[model samples]
Target: MIRIQHLSLMRGTKPLFEDADLTLNPGERIGLIGANGAGKSTLFALLRSELHADGGDVDFPSAWRVAHVAQETPALERSALDYAIDGDATLRRLQVELEEAEAHPDHAAQGHRIGELHAALADADAYTVRSRAETLLTGLGFSQQQMNRPVSSFSGGWRMRLNLAQALMCPSDLLLLDEPTNHLDLDAILWLEDWLKRYPGTLVVISHDRDFLDGVVNVIVHIDDRKLKRYSGNYSSFERQRAAQMVLTQAMIEKQTRERAHLQSFIDRFKAKATKARQAQSRMKALARMEETAPLRAAAEFSFEFREPASAPNPLLVLEAVNAGYRVEDEATGASTERTIVKHINFSLQTGQRIGLLGVNGAGKSTLIKTIATELDPLSGVARFGKGLVIGYFAQHQVEMLRHDESPLWHLAKLAPDVREQDLRNFLGSFNFPGEMATSSIAPFSGGEKARLALALIVWQRPNLLLLDEPTNHLDLETREALTDALAQFDGTLVLVSHDRHLLRATTDTFLIVADGKLMPFDGDLDDYRDWLFKTRLSPAKETQAAATANAAPSAPQVDRREQKRIEAEERQRLSTLKKPIESRIKKLEERMGKLQARKAEIDAKLAEPAIYESANKDELKTLIAEQGACGRELEEVEMAWLEQQEALEQIA
Candidate 1:
């Protein structure tokens, strides 16, 4: 187990944690979550012994080995597999020793040393380490051929994947992963989730992907208000528990405010009167002894909506035998060749439709989205757009296009130059850029901030069609939730390509599978997609049409239009009927829980008073204690009932 006690830490002048305490048990998968600047990474650094705590102690078993993904991967000529294999320091040491022993001049001593080295290497499974490294690379979306390529040959994002694979290749008792899903596609993310679930060591991951956290973590460690809070269960459970706590805190704050006001009023009215002077003095004393309840401070606040488009057009875009890809030119021959990605795509994106693009990395999801966004022209066939169609496209590279020297306000103003400056500021404020942040240069802003700015600029355009490719790459949980809410309520057509399963499920009603240079409608949800990925062994080399269809759920037979509409309507009605009562029950239980918690708090506060323990108030103290216990039991029952209702609602949904 790892124990962190009275752990005070500071980043320069800023205090990140003060007297924080936490205990992490062995083999526990923990999701470390916080706002963008809440020192999550710094805590990881402290755990890795790269940074020391200013006060208190962090202790763990001395023999435990820790592994973490390196932040940088230098450009090297070493094969990718070789670099990943080097992650096992013990194995590398043994290999080096074996080489030295073979070169030794003393024959007898060298033979003994070589024999010992061989036994150690066999014990360490050195012979199979290459295969293990290859598996890690494959799971991370690398091809078999790519495994032999030099580490310097991959791009920055692919290099990060290499770094992740190297970390996973390491043998350790504790593994630390910081945003491991940032560079992964849906398939790779799913694979990583499975891999982490099977890991035998303690795992601490800092990720904003809620589904990923829920799938892999058994506990959540939240950093808030300069303290570490441990919660049992997954991310969803942590959310429910935190929300209930907030509600109880707010109730206590309100009760304290009322008590304070009542005492103040009494003192003001009778402090000078001879008849009630003693009572007024006593009230003042009670007021002075009362503990203050601070107002709730949210970790982050961000909410924005896509403005209603000026016009809505049916069949907003059409692709007719479209081969969506790019053209490659030969410098020496002065000849160009068209490289097709998604071929023969015949589809129409209608108004108010939400579609998610599903595919492995490099399988051309981005190419299809780019084609629809008109960023890339269809190489072979005609691509048509409606007369009044307006496109608002967001991609990772668009974030790079943002001017570093410019402010959020400047970006918005440039898009809508005629709008009022205050209106623009208000718009930027919705994306969490308030006051000076709106006007300050974005040069020093983090990637999340830059992504938010890019999104704000897009929402301001009021486009009839929204095309997003991995828009949540740098966003934290709060911003992602805000974006999810906005996208769910959006009235425009949406075609999203994202690895975030939560966002994909929340905002998309349909899915399109991009594979083997073709696009097709997928009739199932994310779960089915996961099964298909596993069954097909998703990789660039194995991505064939036959393999994709082999494991896919059978397509439903076509029916009459009227019959199909009726079936869909009936299903909707049935779901609504099933959901309504569970939702109502949940609401009622929440109300009851709040009242019970507030009453319990009031009783506890009264019992804490010194006068309550005196002989005169002994009976009243006993009554208060009895009532507190009853309230506690009732609260637990109501909370359990609420949990059941929530589970039912989720199932119905």
Candidate 2:
């Protein structure tokens, strides 16, 4: 549990939290929400002990283990699996001790130490830790081969996934995750949601994805006006509760205003009258000391609409047997090759159709979107557009192309030189860049600000077709909601590739999946897509191996029935008899290991109780500790036997 008392924090001169108090119990999953710059990150920093409260205390039990994802990972030569398993500090320590003890075989004390180290490793289930780490990598879309590769071989986004896996590997009482899904694909996001639900520890997640919050968190903590307020339920519940509270807050302000007016009136009437002077001064002091209730400030209003196109295109674009990807040519041999990512994709969009592209990280969603946007050419077939079709493409990289020295006003004017300045300014206001912000250089702007300017420039072009890929990556909750509303009202054709489930549910009418080097229509909603992903993707490694074996297996010619039956029966009987003993031993060992694990877990729960370590119960505590050690040693012996048996079984094959 954590306790915060009269906490006040300042970021430079700006007050983030003033006199805020909070209590967070163990095993609570909380979604920390606020507008950008509302101090959510600051609060997390305070808990992480990177920052100190300005006025009061933030306290937690010293025994509580805290875990958080590393913001940066330097390129390292260590294998990804080894790096992930390094998160378990206790396991690593025991492993080092065991190695040293085994090396010093002449020492009697070292022999005893080796047994203790092995027992400790067994208690942590060290033998299966690699499998657990591999599962995390797979859930985050890493191939099995990648798990064994050096961490330096992965790109930035993949490195972030490795960091997340490492954090999840650590055993902790409290876990702090900040924007965990920012670099994830839809499949990874869904996997993370399920993982968090099963995490039996306190979780504080900072995210703006509404649907994700509703699925994983049971509580919402919002930061507003330099105060922290805890809501009773999830993000949706917090929204509803905050809206009602705003209304009530405004009503209280009005009542406070009336009371102030009444007090001033009495003071004015009684002042300068000898008999009433004393009462007048008292009333004056009372009026001065009374605190005025601040009026509620409504959320900022941001709205925009796509401009009408110069010409209407009934069918915005069409793909006919298109192979979308990179085209390579060999100059020396005069040979050409096309590395097709999405092959034989055929689709067409009407003027107002809204389509959402869904797939795993490397399943070609982005490649298909780039091809549709004309950034890449089709390798084999036609990608035809309707007459007078104009495209507005917004990929994540588009924000980086803005001229650093230019402002929003300058960029819009360059697109439409003849437009009136007032109209341009008004349009910029709709994207929340008003007056001076539109005129000032955007070199120092945040990612969200740059993204808004890019969209504003696109809308000003009156594009009839739009292609967006991960447009909500850097957007805050308010901006994401604003973008969702704007897209919902868009009259032009839209094609979006995003991990945001809320935006997909609200804006897209059709779902297309780019998978297995093909683009196909998917008849389902986001929920159905999630179900499909889990069902089909849970055992990707097995499927790949099976497919490989199927392709490589030898084909036998037709033979006499008696000959085939005789050969098959002999092989079956031989393999069964050879493998039975090893298999039986493995099964018995596994059963014994399971019972030992259950007993260990029961002891762990009892050990966690504070009263178990009291003076009166010291003997009981010592006995329990000895029992736990015995169980660990037994489990270790069973695991060793099981492994040897499994090896023998594999040899029989």
- TM-score of every prediction relative to native: 0.85, 0.80
What residue pairs clash in candidate 1, if any at all? none
lDDT (Cα atoms) of all candidates against the true structure: 0.87, 0.84
In candidate 2, list every pair of residues with a backbone clash. none
Q: How close is candidate 1 to the true structure, as a TM-score?
A: 0.85
Tens digits of lDDT, candidate 1, 1-653: 99999999989899999999999999989999998889999999999999999999999898999999999999999999899998999999999999888988886778877999999999999988876777788788887689899999999899999999888888999999999999899999999988887899999999999999987887899999889999866798688668767766776676678878989999999999999999999999999998797765677567889999999988898899999999999999999999998899999988889999998888899888889888899998898899899999998577789999999999898889999999999888878899999999999999999999999889888999999999998999998999999999999999999999999999999999997778999877897687567655643335344445566778934448687557655765677688788878877887787688668767866764556888998899889989988998887788677656654664542
Worst 10 residues of 2 by lDDT: 538-547
Q: How would you encode candidate 2's per-residue C-alpha lDDT over 549-586 as one tens digit per residue?
A: 56774863445868755774576568778978877886
Worst 10 residues of 1 by lDDT: 538-547
Please state the error at residue 268 of candidate 2 in Å: 4.3
